[model samples]
Target: MAMSKQQRAAVVAILVAGLLGGAAILFTGKGGGSGEAGHEHGEHAEQGEHVDHDDHDHGHAHDKPAATPASAAAAAAAPAQAADQPHVIKLTPEQVQQAGIGIATAGSAPLRGSVDFPGEIRFNDDRTAHVVPRVAGVAQAVPANLGEQVARGQVLAVIASTALAEQRSELLAAQRREALARATYAREKTLWQEKISAEQDYQQARTALEEAQIAVQNARQKLVAIGAAESAGKDGKDGKGGSLNQFALRAPFDGIIVEKHLSLGEAVKEDASVFTISDLSSVWAEFVVSARDLDQVRVGETVRIRSTASESQAEGKVSYVGALLGEQTRTAKARVTLANPGMAWRPGLFVTVSVLGAATQVPVTVAADAVQQVDGSSAVFVAVPGGFAVQPVKTGRSGGKLVEITEGLQAGARYAAANSFILKSELGKASAGHEH
Candidate 1:
């Protein structure tokens, strides 16, 4: 290239200007690089993490809505105060009365007396009787109907027996002989006293009288053995007539006829039961007790018997109690005699028998309703000034409506007698608030 003096100066000036511009660009790039590297080094030192500026700004924009300082502080304090709020219940005094809630003071009180037992009504064995045929005979007629009440010696049925007929015949013959013997003895005595007959003749007549008397006695015995009664004459005197076979049976006791086995014209054995009579004036309450209850029962102890079938309640004394438990049920039998005055207690009716024995007094007791169950443990709601609080309780033997409080609750503390559920709910609400 050809250069003039002016061209060389201009070209040289253009080259110097280009060199200054390049140095300025190099310095600006170095300063920018240094700034980025410094930021990376600081982030790594502070957080032990490599920093990417583009990603940092992207995440910062996404989290901006959730970073309110006021909301964070409020959320942190919400749970702390929730547990302190009291649970409120709106209930009037009348509602409490209707719900049966009140304080029951713990003190000595008699436990309710209740005993659950199972028994069946039965007739008094000693007062019952079975009608049996005294001799083999045919049942002529049964006058007594089922459940018909009869008195002792009342005719219940009729029976025909050949043996009875024969016995009556013998009794009639003997009566005639006795009359003849009495007449002969009277004549013999008169003759001897008057000296109008030979002494030997009078003696023979007396001997004949003695023989006739013996025969009469034997005949009377024979008649009695065959259920034959000597007939009374029309004038209510002795009429020694031969009697026919009996056509009626008599009741042996005062009772209601419960069963009749024979029918009209039916042949019956000498010992066959013709009628079953039950005296309902007194009944038996029989109870079966377990072996463990033996000590609680005694022969003279009083017992209460109740039947759901009737309104009659009876008190009875233990008449008998089996000493040994049954081999099958491991239970002993106990019997009580109850006076079924109106025969309200029927045989086979179910009855609840409660045998009362000696009472053991407990030192302290509380109403059963005051106790509640919490988490498998018994608890009581103790009435405080503001509300009811739960008090864990330990209970011993229970009697009726009262239970022995051994622990957790004191003897003098007042507790919610009833409607404890409402109090429990109030306490739960307070606890929830306190937990907050």
Candidate 2:
């Protein structure tokens, strides 16, 4: 079987062409970041998430990429894009919805401007009282304790005062003398009518009776000035009664005992503040305003108060504003009175005061939660064809619920509003895969 030279050359060329085609297929199946990323993402997502490959299906196969012109081009461009911009988060409409991320459109909104100031909760001075003993005494029994609620006219403590006893004794003596003088005056008048006594003698008895009555009235008036009841306690000396020195201190109004300076067996001065009671049904939120910002605050205006230590917040009206500024701080103090049910607004708690001003419309605004930090710059996840693209943005003034975007985001652009951290976590994973 002899073969010709031309036929042998043709067989060698066919073998060379087949070998080259196989090598090209092998290379195409092995390399492509996009397909590798998509496969890895789909596999990792299966444990906790469900990703749809519907119309947004990836061009690359799971294990081996199809190596189509579109998939290859995407694979080649992924690294360069990741280096310059945030990675495009690959997600279908169903998957994005299933992820529990609320999508909202950015547009104009009427936002009220606010001025913030630090503040503190304080006792309403109008409802607070510093109780004084009024008379020097030894505290015998102090029933009121610190942080105790008290009712109006409730006995707070008992005081034993020698000075009080002496005054009571004087009143008792004056009463006895006045009784004797009245008897004499009655007898003298009868005798004078009967002509059994001289007119001058009857007149002298009448004058003496009037002088005794005046002495009794003066002594009684003296005891009344020091808050002592003439009928209180025992007047025992030869009369079967209790000690007159015992003085009961009673609360002037219904309140809580916030301060206590007297203890059992303690000697208190006449002017000492033995107790401090305050009606805690209301509290004052106090803040300082700079001289330049005083015009923003006014009496009868409403304000918002937020606790710095917790999530408690409240609304109140500005009740007072100082007419003069502080000499050292150069600021005027202001206060807002608020109803405090359940005692939520406790005194001494630090707070944030927000004074709301007139509203203004903004061009492009979104929910406050939509803005995220990527690479130390603020950015928003914007909706693209198949997924969200990271958009760097510049932020302006912010209301509590909405924020104004000055650059990089257009009106009517849809963005993640709530639960956006899920997208942020996925973005971080995609970036790490590229680095590896």
Candidate 3:
């Protein structure tokens, strides 16, 4: 089938157009980072461009892209706009999970004032005493042992002394003298009534009776003072039932026997110590306060004491805060008086003292979980209309689980208490995209 030249040229042109159109469609589909697909499609475009075609499909299709340059440029700038736009964190249905953010309204409670110090138990000096004999004696029988409880007037020991023997002799002689004085006084009265003796003789007899009675009275008083009972007189109990001059060391006050220095049958001097008694009804807790914390302390303020060695807490009032600080330790001494029940707060015991001070109140407080770090600053995630945002905040004093928010949030604001870190990471990724 022979044809003319114009018909053959027209057939070739149609064939070239169809091939160019197919190659342009392939380039549009492969402009992405897909290496092999783009490489092959670019090769197909180069080959089609060289092809001579009066009717070219790529010529028509490629012209459409140039028509919308402003639109494409604007579309390319969309990612940049997102980067410049303030971050709006989108939460998944699960991520939108609400966290229980604890918030508190500030109120006042008794600010239990407290102070801490290191202390040890000590005996009250004023209430402690040592039993000593007033006169030199030989220790006879020590009836009470060491650590024995004795009452006032309870005999601790009996001492036999040469001084005691002399005192007894004087007492007996004085008793005879008193009896003689009474008889003499009666004789003087009779003599005066009978007028047998002269007035001067009768007056001398009366003066002698009075002097003798005074001497007897002085001797009896001395015996009674040396721990003896007087006047077994008048009841026919006039005989010396007990040794009048035997020194009985008695307790001066109601207390516990802490030390016993004298043994039975041992010779004791006037200065020798027989027993030491401590009144345990009240005890002292000696505490050491640091120099920095000294000003917070005051007398009569209550404090709490506890020991690491045992599970006991004792309450006491500060009896004194030492005027002078320790030169070596640089600590002031605080004396606390605690009621020792059953002698539980023993002397030489180590304890910890807590002195509570005034408390400061704040108007607003939030949970520690609500606070998050953003851009190297402390912030919190606050729920907004569309999404959540990181808000910077200023904080003050902190307590357990709660912290005082001085600024950056108000009452009734919802904040994310948990899972805020996830949002932070997401924001970082969005920033990374714009960088690319």
lDDT of each: 0.75, 0.85, 0.73
Q: What is the lDDT of residue 92 in candidate 3?
A: 46
Expressed as tens digits, the lDDT of each residue in 252-294 for candidate 1 is 7888999889887899987888899988999888989887778
Which pairs clash inside model 3?
113-356, 113-357, 114-355, 114-356, 114-357, 115-355, 115-356
Per-residue accuracy of model 3 over 52-83 as CA lDDT, tens digit each: 35236456654454557888899889977775
Find the candidate with the highest TM-score and give its number.
2
Taking the tens digit of each residue's C-alpha lDDT, what string does model 2 give over 336-428?
998997898999999999888778999999998889998799989887888888889999877877999999999999998987778888899
By lDDT: ranked, best first:
2, 1, 3
Model 2 Cα RMSD, 1 decimal: 16.2
Candidate 2: where is the Cα deviation over 4 Å?
A: 1-76, 81-103, 170-230, 233-242, 381-390, 421-436
Candidate 2, clashing residue pairs? 234-242
Q: Model 3, stretches more than 4 Å misplaced?
A: 1-108, 193-199, 224-245, 288-297, 321-334, 355-436
| Segments of candidate 1 deviating more than 4 angstroms | 1-107, 110-118, 198-228, 232-243, 288-295, 306-313, 322-333, 350-352, 363-436
Give the worst 10-residue stretch by lDDT in candidate 1: 232-241
